[model samples]
Target: MTIDRSSMTALKVTLIGFAALASAMGVGRFAFTPLLPLMQAHAGLSLRQGAWLAGANYIGYLVGAMLCSMRVPATRHAVRYGLVAVALLTLGMGVTGRYDVWLVLRFGAGVASAYVLVGVSAWALPALAGHDRSVWSGWLFAGVGVGISLAGLLVLLAGARGYPPAASWLALGLASTAVAAIAWAPMRAAGASAAASAATQHAGRLSTDDWRLVLCYGTFGFGYIIPATFLPAMARDVIPDPAVFGWVWPVFGATAALSTVAVALGSSRMKSRRVWAIGQLVMAAGVLVPVLWPGIAALLVAAVCVGGTFVAMTVAGLQEARRIAGVNAARLMAAMTAAFALGQLAGPIVVALAATNGTRHAAGPSLLAVALLLAGAWALWRSPD
Candidate 1:
């Protein structure tokens, strides 16, 4: 009935990793999604401008992912330093209303987020596996969704109370700072263990399967991002009530948080790639839902479907990376992350260009995303178990 010392340590480590991810990804990377509508209403921000800000963040993500792939920073150092950067950059977003300044801040946050993501995975996954608590990975990754839900709910509450975008930004920044403080010591304890493991992994070229995994991950990134980026805005268009439309993002994030844990619990017999394939198919269906149905109801369905599967796909893909690359998994994880970043970087630009051409909704890009997701799912299905 009593938990052992090692078990306690493993749980502590997992919770720290969870907090790090929630701060880095939920606040640093995605606080903008829920805030975009507030910015549009109170700050006179345009959809085209929002798209540019999103694009800038994704570009920074690509840069950070590439740096991680090269192993430019130690895992613990990267996580600790990156968390600090994320807190600063997120707070900076509220310091000014200038579009140019916001661009720079979002970009910096993106870089910090990628570093934390790769660093945490590199650091925590091994420790969890060592303790035979690998199932805890679902909870670790669930930080992204939980963070997303928290950020969304905060913004939703603030918007209802007549708070401006800056106020919401400040609130999230303060919250991220607190999370960083909590995660600091445990993350520092990761030391050189992750790097030592990486040093022993294969230095050979990637196989066809590895390459396929990277490409499919990239497709998944592109496929889900349109809705991920603009679901709140899209819902706002369909129904203008902030109280009503504001619920979309939190619903999306809640589904995402819960689904990963469910998959972790139930996927013992399934191959990681197979789980990933099914997730993609489900996401593709979600992307197609609004286009086919054209209503607020459909958008909520898309949110559930897309949000639910994206994190599951992320867990599956990363687990597959570890299975295939062993101790060398960090580099492979980074490479896959870079590809995902590239896909993410493209999504906003696609939307920006569409807006420039006077297309308002995500329909056009959503269609393209669905096609690519279907293709990715097909490729993943063909991959060996």
Candidate 2:
């Protein structure tokens, strides 16, 4: 059977969205995770300093999401230029050793990653639905996992070869450049259809259920970020072996990449909130594992549990928002994202403050995250669909 023009266009949009997300989220926002331990080893970067850097990126993410909520940047511009910005900022990290300079670069990268995510979703989702190819949206989000895994594996290989964090950063930067180039042309051809409609949505009035969804999504963000941010570093503390510890992130990313596809296929049978609640519950159990067991094995389990579910949670949360809000979904989604960003921003800060004398594991904060996640899951399950 021959594929029609709309089908080809939808496929192109999927490819563009995937490449953009991988660059923005994987290399731009999360490359830092795998590189963090290397920085600590080669650059004498302390855990507190790392936490600060993570916080800076999360702050920028919040700012970018807010900007998108306000519809400040055109969709195509955000996707096209945001990919370029992430590449440049990622490259800048390799060239700098100063702590302050690193903070600025990470912050800028966080903004660019958010722009690409929002822009691509807005641009591609409708285009796919119009083509009757909305099933590809799951693959679009899989870019995040693919990017994360690729970046982590690259750092793992580079670090094994005795390369410095700078080298890994530079390599990731170059890879991001290539990924950005793949998405460039298709993004240009994609129409700016979603931005205008999203701008006029009156999302100011939120019912109780809306508030619950926002808070639950925020809780998901806070619950997952601690391990997501520092798992490799934590694993290194147990094994001190890059080969073993390095696998954690790749496993995490691989699980995440597969989980979205699984959910997308199976989601027709279950309500989004139910899927979300179950995922969050599993994440809470995962977060609880390291706290209770305290070893590399537990952290790996945490990685699978958390990573497998975070993206699914994101997909479900957005779906729930759209279901509840209809045309107002854009504003609701923004509110949920801003809440999530705030939750992520708080995760690293809480870790920074809770850890004493450069310790990697903070049991108290982990337990707190577990509690929040469990509570969020319960809220999601109890809320009417």
Candidate 3:
């Protein structure tokens, strides 16, 4: 059988698309969550400072998403600038001896990550047809999991070997640059002709449901981030082995990757609102596990449950936004992203209040917040015309 040139080209395009999306989604956004503890320890950051840094990143993400949603030319220019920004910001993260500078760098990284995610999703979605759209989109999103897991592994290796924090960050930055270089060819091809057409067709103002979805997604963001940003440190406090902390993150990322696919499949058959509510409930249960059990097993279970639902909520929330906003999907997505950013900003502050009591009991208030948010989401899901 003779191989067709067009078929080969299409295969190459698909592979490249996945790689680019993975680089943008995975390494760009998620690596920070897993590295929080290392940054805190090496940089001598207080809990409040750590929360502020995390919040700053989310704020930057909000800014980037909003910027991308506004003008076609700005969005296009962002793709080129965003990659370089991420490379530099990530490289700067290595030099965390200065808390203020690290906070600024993390914020820059968040901005760069938001642009990459929004830009790539916009460019990639139209190229996909029917089921391929969902599949590719889920896979692209899973890049966050892959990137997170890799970051954990790298940090674990670096920390164990007693590498300087700056060196580890620098290495991660170099790796990101390499991924960006590999991604450049495919991103350029994907964005070449269709960018203008897609922008014109998809760009618009946000709708009422867009607001509701944003409010709901912001709650989901608060619910998930509390666990993600603090779980490792929590585990380290309870677990006897320092090495155990490293495993928690990989577990979180791995389960998150698997659950994202599951949610994508479930969305096709079930209403997104229902799926989202259920995911939140599941996450609440996960959050409570460590609180109730106060052991490594509980922490492991919590990571899986919370990690799975975090991305699932985003997927379901975005789908709901599309249904509610109709043609204004891009604007709606940006709005939801903004809501998520605000929620993320609030999460650590909320958790910090619980931590002030000087007990692992902090997990209790955090989990309670998650449960209440999910209950509210369920009510929202049930509401009808």
Best by TM-score: 1
Candidate 1 residue lDDT tens string, 1-385: 1223342378887888889988998998899999998898999888999999999999999999999887636877888889999998999998899999999999999999999999888878877887788898999999989999999999999988889999988988999888878777766655646556555655557778889988998999899999999999888887878898999999988999998898888768788899999999999999999888888999999999999999989999999998998767888899999999999889999999888422355788999999999999999998787
lDDT of 3 by residue, 48-154 (tens): 67667777787788777777566433334455567767877888887557778877887888888787766655444434432245545565556666667777778
The residue pairs in collision within model 3 are 26-143, 26-144, 94-166
Model 1's alpha-carbon lDDT is 0.88
lDDT of each: 0.88, 0.84, 0.67
Q: Count the backbone clashes (under 3 Å) in each candidate.
A: 0, 0, 3
Question: Model 1 TM-score?
Answer: 0.96
Residue 66's C-alpha lDDT in candidate 1?
Answer: 93
lDDT of 2 by residue, 17-117 (tens): 88888899998889999999989999999999999999999999999888877653556788989999999999999998999999999999999988887
Q: Which candidate number maximizes lDDT?
A: 1
lDDT score at residue 237, model 2, on the 0-100 scale? 89
Query: lDDT of candidate 3 vs native?
Result: 0.67
* Ranking 1 against 3 by lDDT, winner: 1
Which pairs of residues clash in candidate 2, taking residues 3 or more apart in a chain or in different chains? none
Name the runs in model 3 displaced over 4 angstroms: 1-25, 72-76, 130-133, 202-205, 323-326, 353-361, 383-385
Which scores better on TM-score, 2 or 3? 2
